[model samples]
Target: MSKMIFINLPVTDLDASTRFYKALGASRNPQFSNENAACMMLCDTIGVMILTHGYYRTFTSRTIADARATSQMLLALTVEARADVDRLVGAGVTAGGRADPNPPQDHGFMWSRSVEDPDGHVWEIFWMDPAAAAGDTTGVDA
Candidate 1:
């Protein structure tokens, strides 16, 4: 069987978190969802489990850190095109999310932007040209 990855996050507001994820093109998987937690499908192989703070604490003994106050990790998703990166971030912003404090990155070959959800969880959307990234100096100046 292929290995699947699930990124679990603690959320203060379950309903709002659900909406935020849905806006990012993820759908709630009813089979793994309940009142306290929602299983969001980002794609076939990846999922996100958004659990209430109370429930999330059960999984860890350490205190749950506020994502807004500290950076634990950054979740990134590679997209098909630069426009797709923009579209996702745009939807996130419209859904009451904030754009990354840092400016968007444009590395000629790769373009990336980040958006923070209402819970302050950061999601990076990026796209890269294979040829450019592979050192195929086609149109690069340097």
Candidate 2:
């Protein structure tokens, strides 16, 4: 299958967003991250295009949601394992992000936690055991 790639988000402050994602271990794509937009590299194949509010608004007609007080999108990023979910959240906290108090979710096969960046973008870190997810297994990592 073709690899899934790219997500575009709106940021109020490009510089701040650049610094924020950097703290989460994502590098700014110099080629794209600039005065108008910034490309945050999530992986070799995956990236998030962050555009300034004005630039982002040009593509949509609806009013922009206040990222900190509201949410326009929910982004779930898969992690290597359960520990990775926590690790990412912890890293977010140290970098000025906030972990949602009531957002932990656990099902027999799927587990997730989330944190919000200063810009109020929600990042859901999740882990899914395919065998369990498919109902073929009962054992969960945790």
The estimated TM-scores of all candidates read 0.93, 0.81
Candidate lDDT scores, in order, read: 0.90, 0.80
Per-residue lDDT, model 1, residue 130, is: 75
Per-residue lDDT tens digits for candidate 1, residues 1-142, read: 7789999999999999999899899999999999999999999989999999999989999899889999999899888888998898999898878986447998878899999988999999899887877879788655
Clashes of each: 0, 1
RMSD of each: 1.3, 2.7
Over 4 Å off in model 1, which ranges? none
Distance (Å) between predicted and true CA of 80, model 1? 0.8
Worst 10 residues of 1 by lDDT: 100-109
In model 1, which residue pairs have backbone atoms overlapping below 3 Å?
A: none
